[model samples]
Target: SLQRALWVRNVTGCKNIHLSSKLLLEDFPTDFLRAVTCQVCDHLLADPVQSPCRHLFCRTCILKYIRALGQRCPLCTFPCAPSDLVTPAKAFLGVLQSLLLRCPREDCREAVRLESFGSHCRGHQEADEEGDGGQGQTFNSYLPVNKGG
Candidate 1:
């Protein structure tokens, strides 16, 4: 009856079998977390978009790269177009937004949500640009992707 009642799979193809406890950020491995990171900027993803070739990137990063280089997926160098990109599914986004990151500031160990990480780390953006590599912390609940295309 349980099997007949429901089935779920994460975007990465991991089957969702347990219903009692939700997976926490601490449960994932470093490699799993790395897989979700944006290849271009090497930060936890912001406004993540998937290329036709199945590689992910921060939307802004991909757009900037494409505008400067050419229409291509940065990771695989597959020919890509602006129109060929799509934001992750809401379920996927929800999972991403749930990861926790500590504030990059040495003084602040406060954890931040993934969805608001950009704003939380805005103060360090300049320093990051100056080669200091800003660190920042993570979400929100929204269902825009599942409502339509």
Candidate 2:
């Protein structure tokens, strides 16, 4: 349930700030997780980077934000340069990948690992196009059944 809630928040970019108890605050501090979450996307860190002010964000989210609203830290309004963002430590990425998220596709709600999500989502798209009939859309011929007298 916690994973589903988290998935909904991330995919929909909803500001609903409820975190289920199953997430275990001891294992993941609420504040720390919230800090790493990308404010623009409301998703767990992806290619995380840290501002000079130590604010964390997904690399793309921050870049887009910077491009849209000058070079300033979104949280503190401190001036920020492109070079001011430093890649976050590997441990931070590891923790991010460990968070369980559901597929963004409305039809597929399977829990997907963050690291493999992109490829996993692509597979779903490809599979849908293939359908049960494959690319040729041909059905196999059924053998005739023998009737018992």
Q: TM-score per candidate, in order?
A: 0.56, 0.60
For candidate 2, the per-residue lDDT at 41 reads: 54
The segments of candidate 1 whose C-alpha lies over 4 angstroms from its true place after superposition are 1-28, 105-108, 118-149
Clash pairs (backbone) in predicted model 2: none
**lDDT per residue as tens, model 1, 50-75:** 99998887666677677767899867
Name the candidate that leads on lDDT.
2
Candidate 1: the clashing residue pairs are: 112-138, 113-138, 114-138
> Candidate 2, TM-score vs. the true structure?
0.60
Give residue 67's lDDT in candidate 2 (0 to 100): 74
Task: Give each model's whole-structure lDDT.
Answer: 0.56, 0.57
